[model samples]
Every structure is written in structure tokens, then in C-alpha cells.
Target chain A: LAKTTQPISMDSYEGQEVNITCSHNNIATNDYITWYQQFPSQGPRFIIQGYKTKVTNEVASLFIPADRKSSTLSLPRVSLSDTAVYYCLVGAGRGSNDYKLSFGAGTTVTVRA
Target chain B: EAGVAQSPRYKIIEKRQSVAFWCNPISGHATLYWYQQILGQGPKLLIQFQNNGVVDDSQLPKDRFSAERLKGVDSTLKIQPAKLEDSAVYLCASSEPQGGGGNTIYFGEGSWLTVV
Candidate 1:
């Protein structure tokens, strides 16, 4: 499994844009980058995922460069509700595309109004 | 659709006691996962199951923890002789694999356990 590195914590004001980056210098070729958001006392929820290039959805966006060594999760118009711990996960591929995931200490985003 | 369901939202047990948590995955989800999340840290995968078969349990403390998915639908995880460090949230998640194994997995609210 590729080890991921993320900032321990980040702070943002309301209506700001928060971008959290993760570095996986040894990410595998078949591995995919995924992000999950977890609020206090709840389970982690899937935010976004990407292999390379940029992927966007209603909630957030994920950007992966050519090297695939790093990725960033961009959240637009942050609010207090956006306060949560964000996890960047690298899922290794098995014989098939399916595989297990292990998470590290995530980046805690504090959105203040 | 109904999301993953879990029972006994919270549990409190003393050291050397036993406790169990139950989970029901979303309809037709083939993969089920058990994760332990200590406060202020990300969740760690304890075990993964695919249709009543164990896919991985490398991180599971088999000496004290065991999980079984019967009929490939509902599952249960039990902890024997719980210790203080075992106090954390036990989460159950399930997913239907998408192409390239990137499908979003849904998690239940979690079973809060406090082992004193």
C-alpha cells in the first residue's frame, strides 16, 4: 500500500475555498486516489476519487497530475458545515480492480464563520 | 434506497467483557467492511467480506475480534475481553464495485463502543 501524506490541520473562513493536497510519492500504477469526509461522531463519507487528471462532481473536485504522485481535493464555498476530517486514501489493485484500503491520520479542516 | 444499517448505536462494556455489533449492507452490495476508528484518527479497516467469504482480515485482532456474514447479507462482529484501547467507533460499510473498483462505499452511522 502506498503511504499518503497530508497536513495535520487546516483552517478556512466561511465562503472561502479550501484545497487539501495529499502526496503519495510511491503510488502504484493501478492504485486510485480517493477522498472521504468525516464529521464528528459519524462515519466517513466518500467525497471524490480520481486516477489521473481532474474529476468533478456536485460536492467537490479531485485533481491528479501526470505523475500520479500527488492529488488535491478542492472544496468550493466552504461553510461551517464543511468542518470535518478529510482522508486521502490510495487503494491498491489486486488481481482484479477490487482491493482493500487502509487510512492514515486525516487532515482536519476547520471552517469558521 | 436505504443505506447500510447498524444496531445498538452505542455500547459500554468493562474490561474482559464481550460485545457484539450487527450490520446490514445495502441491497445487493457484495462487499462488506468492518472498520475501527479511534477518536481524532481515520478509520482502519479491520476486515472485509465478499458474499459470506472473507476477503481480508489481516488487520483484525483475530484473538479477540471475529466477524461473520451469514447468507451474504447481514453480518455481526464480536469482541471478546475488550480492553481500554478497544474503545472506539466500530463502523460498517458496504459497496457495489464499479468498473476499475472505484465505486463509492456507503457507511452506517457507526456503533460507539466504550470499553473501560
Candidate 2:
């Protein structure tokens, strides 16, 4: 499993864009980068995933460079409800027999009104 | 489209006592996972099951913890002689294994355990 490093917490204002970067220098070749959003007393929800380059969904976008050593989760037009802990996970393959996705401390995003 | 369901949203017990948690995955989900989440940290995988069979139990403490998935549907996890360190949330997640393909995982609200 690749260990990820992210900021403990970050603050942003409503309607502004927020980018959370994760460093996984030891990420495996087959590993895929995934981001999840978790609110208090709830489970983590998938936001976006990427192997390389950029992948975007209705909720968020993931940008990974050629090296695949790092990835960034970009949330556009954040709202107060966006306040949650964002996790960056690297897995060999999700939902597979070899899957046992590990998580780090995660980045806590505080969206101010 | 019902998500994963876990029973007993919260539990309180004394050290060395026993406790059990139940989970029902989404319809037709073949893969199930159990995780332990401690305060101020992320979830750690404890076990993974596929269709009533154990796929992985490398991290599970077999000495005191056990889990079973019967008929490839609902499952239960039991911890006998629990310790204070076991005071954490137990989460259940499920997914349809797609032959190493990427699929979003759905998780239950989790069973919070407080072992004093």
C-alpha cells in the first residue's frame, strides 16, 4: 500500500475553488488514485478517480501528471455544505480480489459561509 | 437501491466483554469488507469476504475477532474478550467485484463501539 501525505486541514470560502494535493511517492504502477468525501458520522463517498492525466465527474476533478507520484482533487465553486474530510487513496485496483484500500489521516476542508 | 445497512448504531461495553455487529450489503454485491476506524484517523481494513468466503483476513485478530457472511448476503462480526483498544467504529462496505475493474464502494454508517 502506498502511503499518502496531505494537509491536516484547509479553509476556503463559499463559491471559491479548492484544490487538495496528495503525495504518494511510492505509488505502485498499477495503483489508481481515488478521492473520497466524508462528513461527520457518515461513511466516505467516492468523488473522483484517475490513473493519469485528468478525469472529471459532476462532483469533482482529479489531475495526475505523467509521473503518477502525486494527484490533486479540485472542487469547483465550493459551498458551505462541502465541508468534510477528503481522503486520497491509492489502490492497486478497486473492487477486485486484490483490493484492500488503505486510507490516511485525510485533509479536512472547512468551507466558511 | 438500498445501501449497506449496519445494526446498533452505537454500543457500549466493558473490557473483556463480547459484542457483535451485523451488516447487510446492497443487493447482489459479492464483495464485502469490514473496517475499524479510530478517532482522528482513517479506516483500516480488518477483513474482506467474497460470496460467503473469506478472501482476506490478514489484519483481523483471529485470537479475539471473527466474522462470517452466510449465503453470500448478510454478515456478522463478533469480538470476544474485547479490549479497550477495541473502542472504535466498525464500518461495513460492499461492492460488486468486477474482475479488478474500478467500481464505487458503498459503506454503512458504522457501529460505534465504546469499550470502557
Candidate 3:
């Protein structure tokens, strides 16, 4: 499993854009970047995943550069409901018995008024 | 489609006390996982099960933790004598078989445990 590093916390106001970057310099070719979001009492939900370049979902966008060493998660038009802890993980493409995923201390994003 | 289901939404126990959590994965999902999430930290994998067999458990504290998936559908995780540091939320998650886009995992609302 590839180790990942991300910010501890970030803050943003309503309707603003929030971007969180994760660094996985030792990422392997088979590793993919996945992000999860956790609200107060809910389980962490999958946000977006990307192998390279960029991938956008209904909720967020993932931007990866050519090096594959880093990736950024962008949330547009943020709302207070978006306040949550976001985790960035690097792992082998899912469902492989060898893919033992690990989660690092995530970035807690606070979207205030 | 139904999501993963877990029981005992919350638990409070003393140090050295035992506790257990249960989970039922989505129908037909073959991969299940147990994770521990301490306050203010990310969820950490404790064990993984492929069907009724264990796949990974290196991170699980064998001295206190044991888990089983019977019939490859429902699973149970038990701590024989939880410590103060064992106070954390136990999460149950399941994923479908590997597909083109990588199987995305779905998590159940965790079982929160507090040891005093």
C-alpha cells in the first residue's frame, strides 16, 4: 500500500471552492487515488477516484498530474453541509485480496457561513 | 439496493471488558472489512474477509480482537478485553467483486465504543 499525506484541516465559506491535495510520491503503477468523506455520525462515503489525469463526479473533481505523485480534490459551491473530515487513500485497484487499504489522518474541512 | 447493516450503534464498557459488533454486508458482495476509527483520525483497517475466509489481519491486535464471517454474509468482531485505547468506532464495510472501475466500498454507520 502507498502511504499518503494530506492537510490537517481547511476552512471555507458557503458557495466557495475548496481544494485538498494529497501527496503519494512513492505511489505504484497499480495504485489508485480514492477520497472519502465522513460527517459527524455517518460512515465515510466515497467521493471520487482517479488513476491519472482528471475525473469528475456529481459531487467533486479529482485532478492528477502526469507524475501521479499527487492529486487534488476540488469541491465547488461549498455549503455548510459539506463540513466533514475528508480522507485520501492510495491503494491497489479495488477488490484485490492484496489490496489492504490504510487511511491516514484526514483533513477536516469546515464550511462555515 | 440495501446498504451494509451494523448493530449496537453505541457501546460503553470498562477497561478489560468484552464487547462485540455485528454486520451484514450487501447481498452478493464478497469482500468485507472491519475498521477502527479513533476520534479525529481516519479509519484503520483491522481485518478483511473474502467470503467466509480471512484475507488480511496483520493490523488486527490478535491478543484482544477476533472476527469471523459465517456463511460469507454476516460477520462478527469481538474484543475479549478492550483497553482504554480501544475506545473507537468500529466500522463495517463491503465491496463487490473487482470490476473495470474498481469496486467501490460501502460502509455502514459505525458502532461507537467508549471504554472508561
Best by lDDT: 3
Candidate 3 Cα errors over 4 Å, as ranges: none
DockQ of every candidate: 0.54, 0.62, 0.65
| lDDT of each residue in B1-111, candidate 3, tens digit only | 999999999999999999999999989998899999998888999999999999999999999999999999999999989899999999999987467655678899999
List the per-model TM-score of the A chain: 0.95, 0.97, 0.96
Worst 10 residues of 3 chain A by lDDT: A92-101
Model 3, residue A8: distance off in Å is 0.6
> What is the TM-score of each predicted model, taking all chains together?
0.96, 0.94, 0.96
lDDT score, candidate 3 = 0.91
CAPRI verdict on model 2?
medium
lDDT of candidate 1 over B25-111, digit per residue (tens): 999998999999988778999999989999999999999999999999999999997999999999999987676456667899999
Error of 2 at A6 (Å): 1.5
lDDT by residue (A47-105, candidate 2, tens digit) is: 88778999999999899999999999999999999999999999877545666688899
Q: Which 10-residue span in candidate 2 chain A carries the lowest summed lDDT?
A: A91-100
What overall lDDT goes with each candidate model?
A: 0.91, 0.91, 0.91
Name the better of 2 and 3 by lDDT: 3
Using DockQ as the yardstick, the better of models 2 and 3 is 3
Model 2 interface DockQ = 0.62
